[model samples]
Target chain A: MSDIKILQFAPFESFVSPTFWHKLAELKLDYDRLSDTKRSIFGYYTNRKASGCLLEVDYSAYNSEAQVPKFSHVAHGNIYNKNTIEEFKALDKTALLADEGKQLLDDMRSGRALSDASLLTRFFVLSFADLKCHSYYYWFAFPCPLTPALELLSPATKLKEIPNNGNYVEAISVLPAHAQNFFILHVNEQEKVCEALSLTAALSDFDEERAQHYIYCFADPSEYENPAWLMRNYVALLLQKCPTLIGKSLKFLGLRYDQQMHLDNSLIWEVRQAEACNYEHVQFVGWEANRNGKMGPRMANMRDSMDPAKLAENSV
Target chain B: MHIPNESKFRETGVLTPEEFVAAGDHLVHHCPTWQWAAGDESKTKTYLPKDKQFLITRNVACYRRCKQMEYVGEETLVEEESGDGGWVETHQLNDDGTSQLDDKICELTLDESKDEMFTIENGKRSPLRVVTTDDDNEDDDEAIDMDTFEESGMLELVDPAVATTTRKQDIETNPSNLASVVNASETTNSADSVLRTRTYDLHITYDKYYQTPRLWVVGYDEQRKPLTVEQMYEDVSQDHAKKTVTMESHPHLPGPNMASVHPCRHADIMKKIIQTVEEGGGQLGVHLYLIIFLKFVQTVIPTIEYDFTQNFNMS
Candidate 1:
């Protein structure tokens, strides 16, 4: 950086990128706008080194190589997206008696990678499940204490149906800035954009200039007590500040200086028990082109049989 | 992949010094390229090239047109404003005297090495000579201590053998070579105090349909932000200042390319000069062409404290 007296060209103008603007809009929505919103988190990525910001879910905690009785619902188990990790763990033992379930159980116990059907079935269930509905608990025999049973029953809502074999049941692999690690968030482009926009809209009040300045900084709501709810605000602030972030889009969204987990927004979920969630390291597992000229099955990271000639050469 | 070479001047023989001067005067009176510095110095704020320096005006890309907002980091700001008083600082070194190893990485890092190499090749042709100071007697005395810290006095160029041979050939072929003109000035200066006129190198060439005048700069003063068209036209004639000439940014040359412009009528004047030289079956090499251009430019910019000569090889 010697006095750069000599330049090839004279600078003409300075401009901002569209991604920065989108981030600004999102940050404003997250800071002073949206709360308890349906579209809470937009984009997510895993940081192996605990570069804390906001944690949506720590799948790694639940499923790691070091954990006993390795947990891999997506790669080995019968649990779908609709089934929470808690519900998946709590599945009835009787369900495993069926032939397909038995085969899945055998595969899981044998440490064999589950077929694509198992993973897709789970995703299909989660994708189709009506997450927006609320189930009310009745106090009396099938009814509220003060209301008639028939009156308590409300009009049935219509549920959209889709062929599981249709074009919808597709898994997308997300590669973050860290090349070694990736996340398999179950959603498509439309869902991601909608969630990103909603997050940005939450911080719409903040001016663009200020939004550009503090978009990467975590949102601090000291009064909120619940970690889950607090976690949502963190995600909201993060998503708004960095709308383009699939992972590491905000280059400066690094770990905070303070190690206090109570105030830190980076940690999404606390991994309290090892036995509760079984985790396994995936070598390679995703949809690949099959023999039938269609995307089929989950393939785990398995290396080919080593060649004798190559082994001999390595030994030399 | 390539266009065929065709230059009318190459077909004609080189122009003599007398014919070059006559052609230069024709363009100055009829088709001037410079304009007078408008109003006071503060109002214009254009860099008035002192002795031994010249303004090189050219159109460059506008930074204001960028739509994307960029956060210029501290590192970037420091690099941008490192030069003295914001006149982007660059040094003119004698040939083959750079810390080449230090810049090797920057050169290999990007594909911009072609232009970088070209600038180096260009630097080989005209190694910058010693720089002269315009400071008053008192300022010079005070600058003695400062001189030790700074690069003091004129840095002489190590002249190459090839340049001497070329100069001899130019003198032998053309009767009105710049060396003779410089000698004439030298003789006149000996009679009185040294004629300390600043020398500038002019470049007149066709760019597409237009001819442009690009002056070679040696250095600039403090606070010289002469990148814009308005800030560069202070030394031009008043009438010619209104003429629209785009200031282009040179990709490689740093301080030397400042306050320069690509005037529209440059090609027209150049064509006229070529025609004048070609009439006598005379050729036009770079040296003779420069001699002619300065002859006309001197009258147009009479008030400016500068002179034009081909004492050193210009890129």
Candidate 2:
């Protein structure tokens, strides 16, 4: 037991494009004046050609129906716009994370996550846009359940090292865009073939006799050695939906692709998750550390860029 | 802002929206790194196809500042020493002092160094010298007085408070000491050694008014933090940094204005390049428009290492 290593996951780096702030400003003045409500927003992550685990939000993030870019998966989230700086600073971060986490666990147990795997990648943003000054203060949180810690049974292996990986890659490529993010891969060792199945289909066809053939796969956005934080919730979702897999060693595939859509960098790990005696009370963690790595908010001073008067002054 | 009556890409070098799409598809086919993005659905242009609204390439690394490049020529070396604002400007003038399209090609052959600079090998060119001539009058609006010039120069100095804050943030964010390791190696002056650099997300959107493609840049610092407009200026060629690059709202996205290369002179430059090609007995196709556009935009941002696959020849 001492020889086994605990699995670690890289945190998501929030990339807020300038357009997001501009849109927020527009909303504050025109639509959401003095109303500090949670607005539905969505961010995206791409498994292809990423240097780090990133959650990117642009102007289109405000549009729920915006088309997801090629080779990217959408993570639906909400933005809590605070009216004042003091209100933003005074907000209870712990309770906020807990609320979001409880929502995620509920979704998992209710089969909502199974229907839409994107729910497993839930996130939220807390912000205060100083429209008058053109400065915005914000923080991001990628809520993840902390129960049922997964441990690596052995060192991770590259997908290329596994036999018949080409078949697995080929099958995964044909999956619909929605299923591409999270799915199950079944490898028939005797026949030397592989098949990709949607989570809903795989859950319906779960067989304990052939459980050994099932391999959980996810589109990993992290370029680091460790998997991305999204895997923690994914693991929780799997345990909540299928309790029989608890305490059983399973093969997990971190499906990463390059600019050319090649799976040369994909990694495979043998992981085991211990059962949580108290499943009702699952703890949640994951508030993104500020630029200082502390539990705080970061500020962006856009006065020079966003302020029309300042821009006019600079043009001279 | 004059719209061409007909598609005169091979003659006048002005491109219609259809021609822009054709050229963009050609660029994406050759250079897989460049992709067509639809941008905001609400902001889609009626002229462009829905999916092919604009071209974008992200995380293009700019390894070093333009000042760091080794200037080989005596004239450019003198220009470098004059001041930070003193960027080399080359004008290909005829023997009679007139700037003509035919004479520009002749002048390219006369100057061996200039010929070597424009030589495209494996889609890469040598560090560019800023080329501006009397014909580029559209940038006249960017001309600034001495007071504004001096104020911008002073703004380049690093503030002590900001420096300390950045250092503190670096220490706090990087718990594994990975950033320190990268910082240590970056201080070395060796050309081959790893250097902490800035990266840019380059976007090319077709301008209907000018009937040409305009370039926009969003840059990030070494820490991947969004760079301020002043910080982005460091990566741009000094000559064009003030004159050509202007902060404006993106056509397809509602952003607090991004730095864009004005498209006023794009048609004129394209026309000149087309004439030069025709005079050399080679016809310039509309499909190759973006390749040439990317090649010439290097003068505005010479350090950005964006990939533009050059399988074809340009004489």
Candidate 3:
């Protein structure tokens, strides 16, 4: 009982560049005037040289077609821009996250996540851009379903310690951009051959007898001792796709890299997932903590930087 | 000056847009912490490639105010000799054979000091730069008198080390018993001694007019709240804050104005460093321009702990 370790995932720390707010303000004033609709946005997290789980959004995040930087995986998200601060404050935060969680579960159950595993790591932002004062109030939520908590069957192992991990890392690197985020590494220890497969193909080729050979891998942005928050949903998707694997010990690879994109900090975990009483009533928990590490929205006062009158006053 | 036709960086002390890109690429390649951000697409400069608009490094910690670290160096001699007026010249590199450049900067500082006084008289909330001049040795007595008067006028002029020590003691004593117990354990552990210090997000963008890479800073306080322009000056070296640092909008990002280190003197300084490196029989490549730029920018904001690998030899 003392050996059992419940896997604690590191939550993401949202890093919104000033350019992100500026673009949001522009969208509010020009295009999104009085329209508090959910806008499609995307953020990228790098697996290379990260100190923690960091999800960064900049001006390019608004561009759906924006190229993800090398060694980075894109997480598709939506920005719900509120017209007024009052509206933003009055919005039910729990319901918002639950909606996103439901979408994730639906995607996983409908075989969408198996085909495109990126959907498993969805995030959203609720924001109110105060153009008058150039202040922006915002909160980010990386929707993750909380159910059937995974326990470690054994202690986390470094990727380098695993045999022929170099081959797995090499194969994973050459995968397509979309497939690179979440994939399966099929390793045959006797043959000493490892191959990377997409989640869809991996699911089809899933053999119960060779379960130990299948290493579910995700490009991890976390440099901490624990895996990142994205792994929670990744495991949930795996369970949804293959329900027969419930209560079975599985190998997961949190593929991390250094600045040189060398697989130095990658961690492998042997996890056992418990069966949830009801998968239909899944609970979601993922609202990002503010700077104070509290559950609240943060305000960025851009008056000195954005307001022309204030800029003129300061220059004088 | 050895002028190479292929590269004007060594000759002009200024970098062409291509040279700026090359230098930036070099910086990002070695110091992966510094990344090339595309910035706002609408505000992209035609000179720079869309994706390589600027170089940015965020969350660079500033553990203490500049005043706290001021007395630690040989500048204490300058502090003892020059009084209040000498504060402007204390941070100048003594070994750098750039007295002519120093004199020009001093003249500019003197002129700006007068402007600072006028702004204060007008009751305008201008960022303060304490300036007193010690050009004449005979006026040393008067300068010392002025220093005492200025110290009274500026509340922060009190000895910062003493102030910080007392503040730390207050923090240690004020917490509840349970909190103190936890803090005591944390102190013994040593690994959890993370201080809530001020941090700065630094950005380097190419200035078209000056033909030098301009450095911009956005600071946050211990609580991670954005630091006001006046609060930011506390971290910047008092000598350069007034003359070199200005509140300006970032060229790449449309946001509130950021504190930018004006590039007017950057080319002159870079040229001097290039000459020094050349005199030592080493050719200065444009790729190493940003490394040298960051080294000198350290003089301006000495407390911000941004990484510029210290392995390279300048001389």
Model 3 in CAPRI terms: which quality? incorrect
Candidate 3 clashing pairs, residues 3+ apart or interchain: A305-B256, A305-B257, A306-B256, B85-B132
User: In candidate 3, what are the lDDT values of residues A182-271, reduced to their tens digit?
Assistant: 988888878775888888887877777766678999989886777888998898888877777888889999988775668867999898
Q: Which stretches of candidate 3 lie over 4 Å from their true place?
A: A1-19, A44-60, A63-73, A85-99, A102-117, A133-135, A151-188, A193-204, A219-226, A255-268, A274-316, B1-11, B71-197, B271-284, B310-315
**lDDT leaderboard ranking:** 2, 3, 1
- Give candidate 1's TM-score: 0.19
Question: Model 2: how far is A69 from its true place, Å?
Answer: 5.4
- Top candidate (DockQ): 2
> Model 1, range B1-315, lDDT digits (tens) per residue?
222233333433233323333334443343333221111111222222211112222111121100000122354346544532221122122123454522432232222213353235224322111111122343334233222222111112111100011222223333333212111001111111111112232333222222233343221111111112221232344334334333343322221123334444444566676666667677555435555554555433332434232342222
Please rank every candidate by TM-score, starting with the best.
Answer: 2, 3, 1
Q: Could you give the interface RMSD of each candidate, to one decimal?
A: 39.4, 15.1, 18.1
lDDT of 3 by residue, B1-315 (tens): 222225567787998888888999999999877888787677778777888989988778776556434533476546635643343343344224545644644444334435544356325553232232122242234233222211111122221111011122224423322111111001111111112356888999988888889999987644344665655765788777767888887887776668999999999999998898899999888888899899888889977889877467877
Q: Pick the candidate with the highest TM-score.
A: 2
Q: Model 1 residue B74 lDDT? A: 55
Candidate scoring better on DockQ of 1 and 3: 3
Per-residue alpha-carbon lDDT of candidate 1 for residues A1-316, written as tens digits (9 for 90 to 100): 3421210101001111111122222333443232211111111222221211121211111122211110111112211221232332243312222323334334334423111212111101011111222111000000000100011112211111222212211211121122111112122333332111122232434343333322222222111111111222123223323343322212111111122222123212111111111113111111111111122211111001022342232121
- Decide which is better by DockQ, 2 or 3: 2
